[model samples]
Target: MITVKAPGKLYIAGEYAVLEPGHPAIIVALDRFITVSVSEATLQGTINSRQYAETDFHWRRSGDQMIFDNRDNPYHYILEAIRVVETLALEMGRPLKIYDLDINSQLEDQGGRKYGLGSSAAVTVATVKALCQFYELPLSRMDFFKLAAIAHFNVQGNGSLGDIAASVFGGWIAYSTFDKDWLRTVLQTNTFGEILASEWPGLKIELLHVPNELELLIGWTGSPASTSRLVDKITIAKFAEHEQYQHFLAESQKCVQKMINGIRNHHLPIVKAEIRHNRQLIKDLGFFSGVTIETPALQELCRIAEDCGGAAKSSGAGGGDCGIVLTDHTVDQARLISAWNQQQITTLPLSVFQLTEASV
Candidate 1:
């Protein structure tokens, strides 16, 4: 069996604005991961996951496409990963082989509730990595990231794909999205290999170093938000309020850039200040966009963190899910966690998943 794992990601600073090309976001990979294991099979392949109730999903290859036995299968990301990676394999003169894929995830609770830790992106990355190993494809990190991004975009059709980068690189990263419009135009004339080798306009991913004295904390609101739904709403609102939306994007870029510099320079004060500024920017965005980016629970979560001497904000698309906090080591973490618990917020035990030389 060829086994591979990909880490979940949390957006630290940038949220809605990162959707635009060239806009920067600070994201970190969590220690929690989604694992994919692939083993050779005869004719048909099976995909099994306890998270999806232990039932085996069967599939077969027709030419270069993967056709599932069940039309209502819940393996959209997994199937897309297989399709794209197999396409690449066939292009490289390698025949596709049947394999049974086993998937396990740590990005959710015991009840299978997601923590909004980018589980979909992690699973897609893990599947791509597992299949690449199974096919003996020695792809570089950038190539792997591009492949996973393509698979994810085919399903999601929106967002920055910064989560894909975090899952692929596995560390604190400064990420900017590629031009989706350009990719869409190029796909008509280019193969996957050619696109992977070419330069993706406005795409950037750089690993960052965190300050030693800085402490990161995550609080879950026990509610999961659909990032795509929220983003769709924002997209509509953007057309109605184009000027305000542009201003929001500009401010978000500045705030994220400052936060990134703070992380690189080991300046906790600058990072904390930018976090607070970004929080207000998101709030203003929610007001104009007519979407509740931050729920009552998330507001309370951030309040408790601020009262305890930290900067806090909603993590992702932010209707409900997780909020991240950054504080110095001098703060009482136990008190912060206890305060969050009092308000029915669960403080998650997660750390940054750093990349090793071998993994990179």
Candidate 2:
């Protein structure tokens, strides 16, 4: 059996604005991961994941396509990964074969509540990695990332795909989104192999080093939010408030750029200040767009962290999920966590997942 794992991620700075091409976002991969294991099988292949569903999903290969016994399985990302990887395999003159894929996840809490830790992106990347190993493909990190991004975009159809980058690279990263409009137009005439080999406009991913004096903390609101839904609402608002939206995007870019510099230069003060500034920018965005990007619970979470002399903000689409805090080692972390507990927020113990040379 061949096994692979991908880490979940959180947006540290850039959120909604990162959707625009060339706009930068700072994201970090968490220690939590999604694992996929593949083994050879005869007749039919099975996909089993107790976290998603109880019953096994069966499939058979027909030429270069996969025909599933049941079409209503909750493995859209995984299935897409298989389709794209198999397409690449066939392009390389490799014959298809049946395999059993088993998946396990640690992106959720004890009650199976998702923490908005980019589980879908992690699973997609993990499946792609597992299949690449099973097929013995000579794929590089960038090639693997592009394949997984293509599979994810086919299903999601939106977002910056920064989560996919963090899952692929596994560390603190400064990422700029690619031009989705360009990809959509070129995909009509170009083959997957051609596109994979081509340069994607505005796409950038750089591993970062955090300052040694900084400490990161995560607090879960115990409520999940749909990132796509929030992005959809913001999309509509973007059309209605074009000028204001442009201003938001410009300011977000500036804030994220400074935050990236702070991380790169080991300037903790600038990082903390930019975090607070980004929080306000998102709040103003919610006010004008009527999207409620930050919930009251998230507001409380940030306020408590600020009271403790740290910087905090909603991690992702907001609405509900998790908030991240960045502080110096001198801050009283236990008191901050205890205050969060009083407000019914759960402080999650998570660390950054760094990639080694071998893994890369």
Candidate 3:
């Protein structure tokens, strides 16, 4: 048996703007991980889990296809990972191996509450990693990231794969979105061998350094949000090319650059100012898109964090989910945590996932 693990992820800045090719976003891989175990078993291939055992998935192989007799299942990411690996193996003159996979996650609480920390992305990455190891595929980090991303995009239809990239390469990263038109071309070809033989020019992933004195605290609203749904809503709003959106994109990109420079220089004040500026810019973008990017709880979290002398912003799509706070060592994190608790927002205990091989 082979096992692989991947971390959940969050956005530090540039959430909506990174959907376009040139705009870059900051992402942090979380400490929480999804684990996948692959092995041969006596029964038909099954997805076993402690938290989700009640909703287990079992399928049998028919020729090169995995037949899920009961088709209405929730683990589309896992299912797609399996299919993608199987497709690649068969095309490479290797047999598609049949195996039972056991999956588990620390991203969800016992009460089944999701923390909105990119559980799907983590699972997709872990699943692909296990399959790659099992099949002895000679894949580099970018190659692995692209395969997992294609699996995720096949299921979701749209994404920049920032979360998938973060899960694979942990810690903080500055990432540019892949070219969707080029990705769609590869998808149309549906040939893994072609992907193996080609170099993808549209994808960019870079590791970022965080100041040792910097403190990042995450506050969850105790409610889950849908990133894909929110993206769709913004898409339907059709402000992609609007003049105001261009302004927001331009300004937000500048703020991110400023934050990057501040971190590199260890200038906390500029970092703080740019974070708040980025937050306000994102709030304004929500206004233009007519979506609640900053929900009441998230806004409250930021107010509390700022009151404690830290800079804060709602992370990710932000209808709900977590908000992030950044400050220096002098900030009263205890007071910030207490105030968020008073507002019914739970503070998440997180460390950046630091698997450099995965993330670098």
Range of the 10 consecutive residues with the lowest summed lDDT in candidate 3: 195-204
**Cα misplacement distance, residue 269 of candidate 2 (Å):** 0.2
Candidate 2 lDDT over residue span 1-360, tens digit each: 998889999999989999998789999999999999999999899999969676669988777678886556798999999988988888877888999999999999877899999999999999999998888888888988999998999999999999999999988999999999888887787877888889999999999999999889999999899999999999998999999999999999999999999998999999999999999999999999999889999999999999999999999899999999998876899999999999999998999999886654
Q: Name the runs in model 3 displaced over 4 angstroms.
A: 356-360
Better of 2 and 3 by lDDT: 2
TM-score of each: 0.98, 0.98, 0.95
Candidate 3 overall lDDT versus native? 0.85
Query: Model 2's lDDT to the true fold?
Result: 0.92
lDDT score at residue 119, model 3, on the 0-100 scale: 91
The residue-by-residue lDDT of candidate 3 on 1-360, one tens digit each, is 998899999999988888877787889998999999999764478888766767858888778788885665778898899888878877777777678889999998779788988998999999999998888887877777888988999999876789999998888998888778787898787598687567665567888888888888999998898899999987766456488888887988788888878877878888888889989998998898888999988999999998899999999889998999987888998898888888999999999988855333
Clash totals, every prediction: 0, 0, 3
TM-score of 3: 0.95
**Candidate 1 local lDDT, residue 70:** 66
CA displacement after TM-score superposition, residue 272 of candidate 3 (Å): 1.8
Local error of candidate 3 at residue 288 (angstroms) = 1.5
Better of 1 and 3 by lDDT: 1
RMSD of 3: 1.8
